[model samples]
Target: LFLGLIILIAVWKLSQTFTIMNLGKETSESLGISYSLLEKLALFLVALTTSVTMITVGALPFLGVIVPNLVRKRYGDNLSQTKLMVALVGANLVLACDILSRVLIRPYELSVSLLLGIIGSLVFILLLWRGGQKDAV
Candidate 1:
């Protein structure tokens, strides 16, 4: 199915792209990877997958930021681990939100975008707060 294909491609490409990106720019360049091209390619792939996902499922903005950061904070900064973490966390978070949407109003369902926006913003704020606290120490 189109959804499965996009999810697979997104995970694979995300891992490869972020691995290269996290390696500082000078290091990536020295290793013969064109930073700009790879960055552009990664962005394109992400955008394509995101658009497809939105079309099929529904829009859930900030899932990307929320999932990746939650995973990394709990599991550490291993790139390979982070990729899998992103996929798993993103899927689970969506599932949870969908369930909440359906159950919270028995006769009607809440739009996923609304729930994700609220939850994602809170999580992002908490993450920022934690980071700021660490820096202030």
Candidate 2:
């Protein structure tokens, strides 16, 4: 929990910088942000969070990818604004998948990772399809 809190605080502190970083390297540098330093910091934070999560909860395949994409699609591209929503959605998604995995087969449970992988692939395909459609028009 301490580690999680630290990661959360770090993300909160850096969220605005991340938002600026998304605007392209030259733009962010022009805006006085150290692009490389912030990028390294972001990468470190991601590694830390991933390590902590993997150690604590084992693998949660696709949770990281799907949750943020879903949240971003609904909330737009502001990391600061969407981070909390992404966390909440990810938690709820895991909880829901866990419940479904347990209930789907009586006296036997599916792997949560398996469920998430399948769902994530479908959602990813749908997202790509939608993106392609938008580009076509």
Residue 34 deviation, candidate 2, in Å? 0.2
The pairs that clash in candidate 2 are none
Q: What TM-score against the true fold does each predicted structure earn?
A: 0.82, 0.93
Q: What's model 1's overall lDDT? A: 0.80
Tens digits of lDDT, candidate 2, 40-129: 999999999999999889899888988998898889999999988998999999999899999999589999989988888888788888
What range of 10 consecutive residues in model 1 has the weakest lDDT sum?
Answer: 8-17
Error of 2 at 110 (Å): 1.2
Tell me how candidate 2 scores on lDDT: 0.89
